[model samples]
Target: MQKHIFNIHDVVLFMTVAECFLLVIFQAILPVKNQLANRLLSTFLISIAITSACILVLWNDDVSLFTAFDEYLLPYFLVIAQMLKGPLLLIYVIALTEDAFKLARRHLVHLIPAAVAVAWLALFQIDSTDLRFRTLGMTETERQIANGVWHFIKIMPFFYALAAVNRVRLYRIGLHNQYSNFSPTEPSWLNILTLGFLFTWSFSILVHVIANTVALAAPQISDLFGIAENYIIFILINALFVNSVVHTHKLLTTKPEAAKDKVDEKLTDTAIQKVQQGMEIQKLFLKQNLNIDEFSKRINLPVKEVSAVINKHYGTNFFEFMNSYRVEEAKRLLSDNQHADMTVMDVLLHAGFNSKSAFHRFFNRLVGMSPTEYRKQNMNKEVKIA
Candidate 1:
C-alpha cells in the first residue's frame, strides 16, 4: 500500500472547503425571511466547496488515496460541479436582487450542460469501475477530452459573471428611479460581492491561460505554475470566506425597526404639522440628496417621530413624500411659460432630480407622461394660446 503525503496545499484546500461548508450550514440555519434566496446561496456555496475539493483531490500525489477515491468518483464529476458554479451564481444573484424572482421551469436550461456531462461520464466511464480506473490513467485522447471540458468550464463563467454584474447595475438603476434617496434601499454588500467575484474569476481565467501556455512551452515549469495557481486560488477563497462572514453577520443583525426607531415616538400632531410647514416654507425637497434623517434634523424632531408622522399624515414613506413635492414642482415649472426656455434637464435639476431617468420615472408616474412629453404638450398649449 502506498502512503499518503500531507502538505501545506492540502491544509489550505481543506480549510477553504471547511469554510465554504460552514457557510452552507450557516445559510441553512440562518433565520432569514427570504428562504429561497438563502437556499440558492447555500447551493452556490456547496458548488464552490465541491469544486475546491475536486481540485485538491486532482492535485493530490497520494497514489493510495487517489486510487481508492478515484475509483468511485471520476474526475468528470469535478467538471460537472464546476459547470454548476456559473449558473448557480447567476441564479443566486437574481434571487438576491429580484424581489419577484421565482424558480421557473426555464431555469432548468442552465443545468443542461452539467446534466449532459454527468450522463456522458456515467455512460462512458463510471458505469464500469475498470473503465473509470483506466480513464484515470488517461490516454492522450482522454487527456485532451478532459482538458477541453476544463477549458469550457473555465470560460463559461465569464459570461455569467457579466450577467450578474449587469443585473446588479440594473437593480440599482431601478432603485434610483423609484426612490429619491436610494441609500436605504441599496444592496451595497451584494454589489461588492458581485464585483469581487467578477475580479476573482477574471484573474483565475488569466492565470489559467498563462499557466497552460507556459506548461506547453516549458514542461519543467509546469509544477511551479500549478503551485502558483494553488496559492492564488487559496487567497481568493480565503478572501471570499472572510467577506461572506462579515456581510452575512451584517445582514443577520440589521433590524429595520432599529432604523425606524431613530425617529422619536412622542411627536404630536403639532410637530407633524410643523414638519409639513417646514417643508413647504423652506422648500426642503429642492435640496439635492435630501434624506429623512436630514429632514428630521432640520425639523428638530426625532427620526422615528418624523417617519411615523409622515407615514400617518402623508400616506407615503419619506422618499415618495419628498418625490411627490419634487414632481409637483416639476409640473409647475413645466407649465410656467417663464421657464419655457429651460431644458428638461435644467427643470429636472431645479426639481431636485439628479438624473433624467429619475425625473422621467416620477413624472410619468405622477403626470401620466414623460418629462419631455409633458414639456412638449405644455409648450404646444402655450403656442395655441398665443
Candidate 2:
C-alpha cells in the first residue's frame, strides 16, 4: 500500500476540476438562445474537467488508489479523455459561429480518434501490473512508441486550432462585409477563444519541455508543472464564464454569401474602378451602415463580383476598404475648421462609424494615431500654416 502524499498543489487541482464541472452546469442553465453553442461548450468544458480529473489522480501519487481504480476502465479513461479535447473544442467553434448549425451524424467522425486512442491504450500503453504506462523499466523501443503516441495527442490541438481559426476568420469577414460597424468590440469573445487556444497550446509545450528537463535532475519539482497547468485551466474556465456573460450572443449570425475570399482576375478593371469611384466621388462611404449588397446594387454589379473585385484589386475585404475611406473622411472632418466644433464622437458618427471603440481601433490601425492626436496635430499644423 502507498501512502497518499497530500500537498498544497492538490488544493488547486481540486478547485480547477470543481470549477470545470461548475462551469458546465452554468452553461447548461445559461439563458441564452444559442443553446447549441451553450451545450457544445458545456461538453467541451466537461472534457476539460475529465482531463483535469486524470491529472488530479496523478497528483494523488497513490499507487494503492491506482490499483483500486485499475479494477475498472478508470485508468484507461485518462488517455481517452485527452483524445476528446481537440474534437470537442473544434466542433464547439463551429456551433458557436454558425447559428443554423445542427449536429449531424457526420460529426460522429470525430469519435473515431477517441476509439483509436482507446485501442492504442489497450494495445501498447497499458503496463497492467503497475496500472501505469511509462516506466524507467521500459525498453528503448517501448519508450519511443509511448512518446510518439503522446506527441500525437499533444499536437491535435494545434491542427484543430488552425482549422478553428480559419472558420472564425471567415465568420468575421462575413460580419464585416454586411455590417458597416462591428460593435461593441469586434467579436472579442471569439478572438479571445482563438488566441487563448493558441496561447494554451504554446504554454503547455513550454511547461512540458522545461518540466521534463528539471524532472531529470529533481523529480519532485515536476509536481509544480501540474500545478501550473491546473492554474491555467482555472483561469481559462473563468475567462470563458466572463465571455459567455458578455459576448456569446454576438455569434448568432450567418456568413454572407460573398464573404469567403475568391480571386476574380476576370472582374474587369472598370468594375474595380467603379467601386472606388462610388467611395471616393459619390462619398458612398458616408452612408451609415453601408453593406456590400447595397453598394453593389448602386454600382450595378453582382455582390459576389464586387466582393471579388475588392479582394483582388484592393487586397482588403469590404470592411477594411470601406473603413479606409471612412477614416479619410473623418480625418478631413477633424482637421477642418468647418467641423472644429464637433467632438470626436460626432466626427466618427458622421463619418459612418457606429461604435467609438471600433472607430478608434480602426483609426489607430490605419492612420497610426488616435483620432484626438491626429486631430490636434493637424489642427496645430493648420495653425502654424495660418
Candidate 3:
C-alpha cells in the first residue's frame, strides 16, 4: 500500500466529515413537520461521513484501525452506503413534499439493495485473497468483473438524484398553485438541495466511470476529482444546516391538495357572486400580506367556499387568483402617467405584492413583458379625444 501524506485535501475532507456529524446531531434536536424525513436526511449524511471517514483512513496508512478490521473489511462495507444513498435520497424528498407520506413497514423494501451489497461484500471477504482490494493479485478476467460491478454500484446515486429532481418539481408546482407572494427563502433550500444534488452528482458519476475504465489507470486521478466533489458536498450540507437552523420556527409544511372532483352543490352561485362581489367592491386582494383565510373572513364566507369558488370556477388556486387581480392593478397603475413617478417597487407594493420576484414573475407571465418595459411603453400612450 502506498501510504498517503496528509495535506490541505485531508483537512478539507476532515471538515466534511465533521460537518456531517454535526449536521446529524442538529437534525436530531431540530423540530420538523416530518421527523421521518429529517431522520432519513440525517442517515444519508451519516453514510457520507462514514464513507468519507473510511476514505480518509484508507489514504493514511498510519490508521491501524484498518489492520484491526482485516484490512479489506471497511472498504467492502462501503458498498452498503453506496447502495443505500439512492433509496434514502428519494424517500427523504418524498417525505418532505408529501403531506400524507407515512413511513410504513413495507417501505423497507428499499433496503434490499443494501442487503444485497452486504451479501456481495461477504462473498469477497470469504476469500482471504480479496480481488476487490488487491487489484494486482487478480487475473484479467477478475479485474474486468470488478470494474463492471463498480460501474453498476456508482449508478445508484445518479438514479436517485433524478427522482428527487422530479419530486421537487411537483412540490414547486404545488407551492406556486397554493400560495401568494412567497419570499425568496420559502422553498429555496429545497431548490438549492435538489439542484445541488444534480450538480454535485454529475461529477461523481463521471469520476467513477473514468476511474474504473481499464484503459485509463485513473484511480489516482479519480482521487483528485473526488476532492472537488467533497467541497460541493460540504457546501450542500452547510446550506442545509443554515436553512434548518434559521427557518426552524417557520418549518415548511405541505397543504392538502384540492380534490379534482366536482365542486359541492351546496356552494351556490349566489355564494360565489358574494365572494367575487365582495372582493371587487372592497378590493380585498389589495390587502397586504392577505391570505385565503383572511380573504374568506373579509367576504363573510366560509374559507372552504372561498377556496372552492377560486379553484373550481376561476380555474386557479388562491395564490394565482390573488395575483391575477394584483397583476391587473399593477397594469392599471403602470398604464397611467399619473403614477409615472412611482417605481416598479412602489407599484408592486401598492398592488399587494410583497415579493419583487413574484411581482415580476406574475406580471411577465401574464403580460408577456417586464413591469419596467410595460411601464415605459405605456407611460407614453395618449388618450384619443374625438
Candidate 4:
C-alpha cells in the first residue's frame, strides 16, 4: 500500500489530472474570442482530459470504483482519445493558415470507426465469451487489458501521418494566400498553435510506437512505456494552458498603434474623410488620457482608418502625434518658473509620457535636442537674467 502511494506513476497521474483541470479553467475564462486557435486548443484540452481519465481508470486500485462498468470501457475511452488527436491537429493547421474555417458536415463521419470500436469493446466485455475482449485481457490468460488497449490505439499513427501530410499541403497554400503578408514580429498566434501542435503530436506518436515495440520484446518495460502516455497528456495540457493564455493576452493588450497596423489592409475611397477627421481629431488628442479608439469612434471613422490617414497624410502615426502634443505641454510646464525644480520624467508624466525612454526618444527626434539639453539651454538664459 505504501509503495502504491509513493509510486512514480501515481505522481505523474495526479499532475496530469491537475493540468487538465487548469486547462478547463483557462478554456472557460480566457477563450480565444475570434481566433481559430481556440477551437484547436479546446479539442486538444478535451482529448487530454479523456486520455488522462482513461489512464486513471485503468490504474484504479479497486474494480469496485467502476463496478457497473466492465473492463472494456477503458479501451473505448483510449480509442476515442487517440482518434481525436489527428482531427484536432488537422483543424489546428486549418485555423492557422486559412482565413475562413467552415467545418463540413462530413467531418463527423471520421469518428464513426472509433465509436464502432468502442461499442464493440463494450459488447465483448459484457459477454465473457467475446473474442476481442478475451484476446484484449479480461480472462486469466490475459490480465493486462489496459496495455492491450494501448497496443490497439497504436493504429492511429496512420491517421496522424495522413493528416500531417495534408496539413503541410494546406500550409503551403496558406503561405501563398493569407500568411504571405504577415510581418515576422506581428502577432501570428495561429501560426504558433499550428506548428506547436503538429510538432507535439508527431513526437508523441513516435514515442508511443517506439515504446510499444520495445515492450513487445521485454514486458517489464511496459510500465515505463505506460508512464509516457500520462506524461505526454500532462505536457500537452500545460502547453495549451500556458501558450494560449499568454498569446491571447499579448494580442489583446498590444499597443494601440500596433493594433492599428494589424487592422489596416488597404487604401479606400473614404481616405479623404478619414484624413479630415484625423486633423480635427488631433486637437482632442492633446488632452491627457485621450483614448485613440474612442476619438476615432467619436469622429465616425474606423480606428485603423484614422490611424492610417494620420500616418499617410499628417506624416506621423498616432503615438508620435500624441506624444508630440504631450511634449509641447511638457515644454510649457518646463517654461513655468513655479515648477522649475521638477525632474524631466516628472514633467513628462504630468504631460502624459508613459515612460522616460519614450519621452527621450520622441524629444530627441522631434525637438532636435534631449530634454536635459533643453533644460540646460533654459538655465543659461535664467543665469543671464540673474
Candidate 5:
C-alpha cells in the first residue's frame, strides 16, 4: 500500500474546501427567517467546495486513494459538479431577489443535464472496460472530452451570471425608485459577490483557452498547464470564500434598529391620519428630492414622529413611502393614451423622479416588467379596445 503524500497545493486546497464547508454549516445552523435563500447559498458554496476537492484530488495524482472508491465514481462526481455550477448560481440569485421564491417542480429541469451526464458516465462504465480505464487514468481522449466539456461548462455559467447581475441590477433600481434614502437599501455585498463570480469564472475560462492553445504546440507543457490551472482554481476558490465570509459577516452581525418602539411612542393616530391626508390630497410626493425632514415639516409633525407613522402604517421607511407614490403616478402617466407621445424619461421626470434609472427600476419592481414594456402593453390593450 502506497502512503499518500501531502504538498503545499494540497494544504491550500484543503483549507479552501474547509472554509467553504464552514460557511455552508454556519449558514445552515443560523436561525435566519429566509431559510430558503440561505439553503440555496449553502448549496452553491457546497458545489464549489466539491469541485475544489475534485480538482485537488486530480492535481495530487495519487491513484492509491482510488482503491477505496469505485473507479468511475470520481470522474462522474466531477462532471456532475461542473454541470451544477450554472443552475445552482441561477437559483441562488432568484432566491435572493424574489421575496416569494420557493423551489418549484419546474426548477428540477435545471438539474437534468447533470443527471444525464451521470447516466451517460454510468453506461460508459458498464459497457466499455477500456474506456473506463481510460477515464480513470485521464487518457488523451478522456482529457480532450474533459477540455470540451469544461468549455461548455464555462459558457453555461455566462448566461446564469448575466441573469444574476440583471436581477441584482433591477433590485437596486427598485430600491432607488421606491426610496428617497435608498443607500440603506443597497445590497452591496451581493453585487460584489455576483461580480466576483463573473470575474473569476471569466478568468478561469481565459486561462483554459490559453493553456489549451499553447498545449497544441507544446504537448509536453500540458502537465505544467494543468498545474497552473489547478493553482488558479485554488486561488479563485479562496478569494470567493474570503469575500463571502467578509460580506456575510457584515450582513448577519449588523442589524438595523426596528422603528416600532419609536413609532409607538412618538406617533398618534391623528398625526398619522394628517400625514396620510397631506400626502394623498396635497400630492406632496411629487416634490422632487423630498426627504423625511421636509415631509415632516409639511405635515407639522416631529421628524421621528412622521418617520414612525410612515414606517408603522405604511410598512416602509419615509423614503420608500414617498417613492411608492411617485411610482404610482409614473404608472398612471405611462398608461394614459394622452401621454402616448411622451418618452419614458419625460414621464419619469413628470412623476418627480430625478433619476431615469430609478424610475425604470421602481416601475419594474412594482409592475414586474420594464417601463417600456408596461407602456407597450397598455397601448396595445387600448388599441384593441378601440
Candidate 6:
C-alpha cells in the first residue's frame, strides 16, 4: 500500500513539474507585457525546477548519481526559492504600479543573499552532515535541520501575500479615481483570482512545513502533502494561463464595445470642440515631446478628461497619439533630400521618439508596416517619379 502511495505521489510530482515548465515556456514565448504575470510565472518555474530536482535527488533510486547528489543541495535550493518569494511579490507590485514599468537597478540587490548562499554551498564544499543538510533517517537533530530549512523558506510566502494584499487595495483605490464609468480597469475577477492563488499557495506551503515538523504517524503523510501542493500549484498556473489566453482572445475578437460606446457617447458637439482643441494643443507639443500632464494643462482639461478623450477618440493614449504625429514627420524627414544620408533611426530620434524599439512598436502599430518596409515602398515611388 505504501509503495503504491509513493508511486502515485511521484507521478503527480512529475506531472506538476511538466505542466509548470510548459507554463514557463508559454510565458517566455507569449508577448505578455504584464510584468506581474511574467514575474509570477518565472518565479514558479524556477521554484518548481529547484524543488523537483531536489525531490528527485533525495527520493529517486533508479539513478545512483541522483541518490549520491548529497542532501546539502536541498537546503540550498530551498533557501534560494524562499529568497525569491519576497522579490517576486515586489516585482508584481512594481509591474502594476504604472503601465510604464521602471525597475530600479538597486532593487536587484535583493538577490544578493541567495547568490551568497549558493556561493557558500559551492565554495565550502559542505557535506551532508553540515548544519544546512541532513537525511530524514539521521538523528533527530539532523531531521530538524532538514525540516527546519524547508519551514524557514515557507515563511517567505507570507511576505509575498502581504505585498499582494496591499497592492490590491492600492489598485482598487487608484481605479476608483481614475476611470469615469464602471472603473473596470481593475478587473474584479482577476483581483480575486490572484488573491486566491497567493493564499492557496501560502497555505499549502505552511501546511507542508507543519506536517513535516510534527513528524506525522505515517511517512506516507508526506506523500499526501506532496500531492496537495502539486495540485494547488498546477491549478493556479493553469488558471492564470487560461485566463490570459481567453482574455486575449476576447480582446482580439470583440473590439471593446464598451470603450467604443464611451467614445461615441462623448463625441457630441460640445465634446467634439473640446477634443479638437485638445488635439490641436496636443500637436503643438508633439514637436517638444511633452508628457500627458503638460498637454492636459495646456488644453485646460482635467487629466482624466484628457486621458478619456485621447483614449476614446484617437484609440490610444497621449504618448501614442503624439508618437503617430512624430512618426509621420519622421517618415517625411526620411524621404526628404537634405537628410537623405541620415539613417531611419536618426530621423526617428530627431522627430522626438525616445528609443528604437518604441519607434518600431508605434510605427508598426500605426502604419501597418515596418519602418524599413515603408521606407522601401516610398523609395521605390521616388524612383518611379524620377
Runs with alpha carbons beyond 4 Å of true place in candidate 1: 1-4, 63-68, 120-140, 184-186, 216-386
Per-candidate TM-scores read 0.58, 0.78, 0.74, 0.51, 0.57, 0.55
Order of candidate numbers by TM-score, starting with the best: 2, 3, 1, 5, 6, 4
Best TM-score among the predictions, by candidate number: 2
How many clashes in candidate 5? 0
Q: lDDT per residue, candidate 3, 267-319, as tens digits?
A: 58877897788668889878877766567787888666777787677778878
lDDT of 1 by residue, 1-386 (tens): 96657677677667777887887777676676667767877777787778777777665645224554665574565767788888888887776556557899999999887877676566555422333223456676765554555567777777787788877776664443333454432367667767767776776676667756786687556655556555665575555555554554333111123344524445577777877876799888898877666777787876667667777666676668888899999999988889989898899899887767767887898889887788789889989999
Lowest-sum lDDT 10-residue window in model 5:
249-258
Better of 4 and 5 by lDDT: 5
TM-score of 2: 0.78
lDDT tens digits by residue: candidate 4, 25-122 = 66767645545567566776677666666566555553224543335355656677867766676665555444456578877876775675576456
Residue pairs whose backbone atoms clash in candidate 3: none
Better of 3 and 5 by TM-score: 3
Q: lDDT score of model 1?
A: 0.68
lDDT of 5 by residue, 1-386 (tens): 97757776577667767877987877777766667767777877787777777766654555225543434456666667777877887777666555466898999888887776666566545222232333465677666554555566556666677677777776664443334634332377677667767766766676667666785687556655555555665665565555444544333211122345656666678888888887889888888877655677777876657766766677676656777888899889989998889988888888888877777777888889998888889889999999
Q: How many backbone clashes does candidate 3 have?
A: 0
With a 3 Å backbone cut-off (N, CA, C), the pairs that clash in candidate 5 are: none
- Candidate 3 lowest-lDDT run of ten: 124-133
Off by over 4 Å in 3: 1-5, 28-37, 66-72, 124-137, 214-220, 247-251, 256-318, 330-351, 360-386
**Candidate that beats the other on TM-score, 1 or 2, i.e. the better one:** 2
Per-model lDDT: 0.68, 0.73, 0.73, 0.58, 0.67, 0.59
Tell me the RMSD of model 5 versus the true structure.
15.0
RMSD of 1: 13.7
TM-score of 3: 0.74
